[model samples]
Target: MEHTILSLINQTNRNIFLTGKAGTGKTTLLRKIIDTTYKNTVVAAPTGIAALNAGGVTLHSLFQLPFASFLPTYGSVPLANELQRIENRTSLQKHFQMHKNKIQLIRNMELLIIDEVSMLRADMLDAIDFCLQQIRRNRLPFGGVQVLFIGDLLQLPPVVKQQEWEVLQQYYEGMFFFQSKVVKEHPLLYIELEKIYRQTDPVFIALLNHLRENKLTEKDMAELQRYVKPHLGTKTDDNYITLTTHNAKADAINARQMEALKTPVYRYEAKIVSDFPEYMYPIDKVIELKKGARVMFIKNDPTGNRRFFNGKMGTVQSLNDERIAVLLDDADVIEVDRYQWKNVRYRLNETTKEIEEEVLGSFIQYPLRLAWAITIHKSQGLTFEKAALDIQSVFASGQAYVAFSRLRSIDGLRLLSAVPQNGIESNEEVLQYAANKATEGQVQQEWEQGRLEFLQEMAMRTFDWVTLETAWLQHSSSYSGEIGNKNVYKNWAQQQYAKVKELVATAAKFSKQLDGYFRQGASVEYVCERVEKSVEYFIPLLSQVWYQVMYVLEKVYYQKKVKEFVGELEELSNNMGEVVKKLFRLQQLMALAATGKDFSKETVSTERFEALFMQIVTNVNKQMKQEQLFTKDKEEETPKKLNTYEKTLLLWNEGKSIAQIAEERNITESTINKHLIKLIEEGSIVADLDKLFSKKEIEELSPLIDALEEDSLKTVVEQTQGRYSWDKLNLFRKVYLGKE
Candidate 1:
């Protein structure tokens, strides 16, 4: 069970299906992935409530897919008229053409995480697949992107219209997305969490397991009926939440309960400061609350102080035009503050391997919801300490199971009507699948082994970096150390490794956490997050710090290369952003140590040499602090320091490769592509490009390359498919594309 969950922590980018019975921490696992992994992940759910619960967007809202019952059933790109019709129907044409950025976001996506997977139908999933392929211009499944599916099919089955089902049946075996043609062809690896975390009573747990496995018997039904009675008692503070089959029925209970309070009702209209005000409506545009009304916090506290949390229920003690007070179930009364919900777009910083959010707009309001009585349909991702059920009102399959499972224990449940012995139903296909998965304990073991292998590989790579750092410090320099001290460079190297050693040790902590996670999924992803922070974010920047030293040393031996490097710095500084001030200062040091300067003896009066050297060191040190390179909770606290294209190219000119530049800059290649496009348009590197390729070659390649909008080597390789080598493509982009 631990491996089934922990295994994804280290696994390379791949599609995975995380499924289990109610309250198995599926949503918890998704949050962990969002907190740890470096991939550009976008999350979506089939329903708005599910999307908010998942802290993501709705599938339709994110993709702008049509609301039609069936998706287009075809393998090829639609003709012009067909596309036009789709555009007119869904308004996707303007979005696709007007939003170049939206296209880039989709094209560069590494992971698309869908929560509450059971509610997404086969046609809808195929439709998403088609949209991705069309936007990315790739024919591969999901446009060659990795997707994560999270939810249990046994709880909620997809809604299939008769027409959609008829169209889907030709391509899918069933209505579930797993039965879709693309999924059938490229099946995602399954990981079912076996541990039950929501319910504590073993006997009650056994009944839930039987429900999931389709093994419910008359005896189990009799056990369930013990709590079911003809008349439910009057509402009390401890009464379980009523579950109904219909929204209207649930609304009736809520209205009646609120009216029963006989307290003054305050109606507050939400203030939306965003473009999509209608979409921002979670429960409604106007929220009605009364004193003594049972209400739940719809969002976590902004600072995450835990004074309030999503799904935490309480009673409204008082309210006015300027204030609101809530008494939590724990009897602690606190003034409630308004929180802002932003509609954010994320950009992956390839250099940092961190997701950066751009706040497009926001909805500012107190996140409180009426909680006296909620429908079983609306109660789906929530957990309750106490609950009541009206199983007699259940109209669809799995509704009863959902209603009963919200309670923490059987003792908390009070059912208001007799339930049929065979009233509850689960998807038989899912039950059979879970049954089969139950026997494959080997898969879980394999997951553990794979984790060990990834950790070992990381350890080995860390060792290689240490070796590279040490050799560069010791052997690469043909000259002596800082003036008046032959060991000045060696001392600098020592200082560098001391930091490296510290970071490596910081990274090693994950090994212990992996051990802990192998036994219990630790609530805090301490190791996964710290390792990601240490290696991906900090170490790369640290490595670039060493590369700076190399750049200075290289200037003495490779004068021409050093000249090219300085030119890049000067040109980049000349462009729109701030100058790489430290590197700009380093250029002066290189000027003093030009072509044949001997450093075997003290050549400088301490004042000049020490002053300049100290300045360089101080500048580098200051940048590290600004970036918060050593902070443990930087991901949560610090704002990102983006590496401008000029600085990225300066590192490039220092002989660092694109991958190294990405590490040094802390951003991704797609993001890097955006920077380079701006650089080309700015004419900052026109002279450099002229030297790399002839004008004729540049002209010939520029138009041919224009056919492909992106400057990535992969795009060139993919479009030309070996007609040109990577070197040629790289040189062409560097020399030709941004002609001045």
Candidate 2:
């Protein structure tokens, strides 16, 4: 089965879907395929923790989806402006160019392996399909791209509203459940992996199989009890065995399994389940912890999987009597009160600075550091070299099994204690969860079926006519001289026109498909129902296209042309004002008419109007003749030179104050004053002379007074005590009013 799956993945034109039980090496196979086949590949995990474990980016991040928000139901359809912007962006341009290059390089490629496919809701898959299709510009499924989907349908399904999921399920129903007859007809490659790799103990494997089949016998229960027994003295000397909530059993188990150091481990070196107090430690204490200081810090939130420095690593930077500053190699430096560090013991290395430099250098370039202690959820896609697991602790879920199975080999597994079976609930809880999911899936399937039927029917009826009309319009426009020679200009116009037609046709088709799919029955598979419900997803795209098309035709074609004409007239008026003055007058009349204002009743004879226009034209011609003559004469002469006072006045007019002129221009203040006085005497400048006490020239002096008051108040307020409130308030008022 594995070979078949691997072979399909290797095929140039095949997309493979693999489904099976958990611990069946689905992810393992995916990793192998990625490592072996595709070079320029992206491994996108659904969750942040999963991505971290897989050493890949998360799906949401890759899609640029809003964090913690529902996925957008409608696919992205770029507007003309947005498309242009995307074309201009260096990153996107590079990405597109690279993909084009890759296509040329490979000619063909291997599968796009998407692991945990079951966890992907129908809508999410549709979104992925939409993006791929758009980028490749291919009409076939996933842009005719080969995709490998691996997941067990029985496992955790997508997290979404049940109704939304149902809609998506309906849209993809046909593809989800490929009947043998249908499979033969379409020839879709499907492979199932059966062998369980993690639960190698025959007895253990048998018991799990029984439990999975809901056929656990009395012997099975007895075996489970025996398997769950706790081992004595397994905990490290410094590490205490502690339980949090029954829900955290998995975390406790994993925490206990971490390898213990042999270096005289102090009780403070480890903590079982301790909560770090927020804001209790001072900043200085955080900076005092030296390198080689062994420390174990507890993360209170089970889901808070901060990679580094969330109370994890410890290294000293500086120390004082009251506080110590410690630096986390990954997280920023923090200071804690010296009193807070009293309980923790560490032998500070004298050569801490050298060690710090070495450690900091190692991590200086990386974005984030590897986490020392991680939650089981964070361990999903990770395969550790060695893992220590304890199932006896609190809050253990089925996820514990999943985490344990992540290790590639059994030799890497270090069991801290026997796996606990006590908290295992009756099959009812698990069955209920599965039933709810299945029900949601059914709803989605029904919606998808309905949508498909509607699309098919609509395609046959309304869409055919719409598409025909669109083709005729496109043909007419192409042959017509309306489109110009510029490729960008022509393409932009065609796209605007085509988008509307495309939406109308797509909507009609979807409507027909929905009608056909749901007309038959309701007891369809959950996946089918989910796909059917996705019909609404296409509605927004249709609406946007319709609006955009109408806007382009009405505004771009009609209004934009009018505006362009007006703009050209305005430019001509500015350049050839005298000759084009009549054009400006006509524009004013048009503007008034546009505003629904009455025009003047005055009328001129046609001959008189023509004579006036001729006179204006003659005047413009005469001015142009004089300008040409003046330019030739000016070029033949030397440039006029300014006297020192005139030069100083020019600088002053250019916003150089007397003081600045003196300092920068290397002139005396008196000389600058003399220049200013001469300019004023010449009547080229205006000022109140006696008050020309630069400070007394009221209008000119106001700015300086305001500045002085502002500075004086600022100094007084900064130096003043609380008891001087009245004086400070007075100073503030005086400064604001420029009365100081």
- Taking all chains together, the TM-score of candidate 2 against the true structure is 0.35
Candidate 1 is scored at a TM of 0.58
Which segments of candidate 1 are over 4 A away from where they belong? 1-9, 69-98, 137-139, 233-238, 300-305, 348-355, 436-441, 444-740
Please give the lDDT score for candidate 1: 0.62
Predicted structure with the largest TM-score when compared to the true one = 1
Candidate 1, residues 1-740, lDDT tens digits: the string is 54344345334334678787788888777887776554467888997667756777778866777665443443433333322222221433334452545665676576788999989887678778877877877788898677889998877788865644554455567778787767878777787776788887999888877766657888887887888754754374763567777888778878888888888888877677755446546666678888888888777777767787666778899998768899988888979887776665555442222245666666777788788777887787777767778777665567778887877788877778876666566677776555545334656655546544444343333323333334434432423433432233455545554655565465456445545553564422343444444334543444445445533343333344344334432222121011122222222322323332321113212233234444555666675565565565767587666557768667656766556767777877555555555665676544365544457756667777778656466866766667665655765665555432
Candidate 1 contains a number of clashing pairs equal to 11
Best by lDDT: 1
TM-score of each: 0.58, 0.35
Which digits, one per residue and each the tens of the lDDT, describe model 2 over residues 409-465? 444445556543443322333343233222334434433443334323322332233
State the displacement of the C-alpha of residue 91, model 2, in Å, after optimal TM-score superposition: 25
Question: Candidate 1: minimum summed lDDT over ten consecutive residues — where?
Answer: 573-582
Count of residue pairs whose backbone atoms collide, per candidate: 11, 88
lDDT over C-alpha atoms for residue 672 of model 2: 70
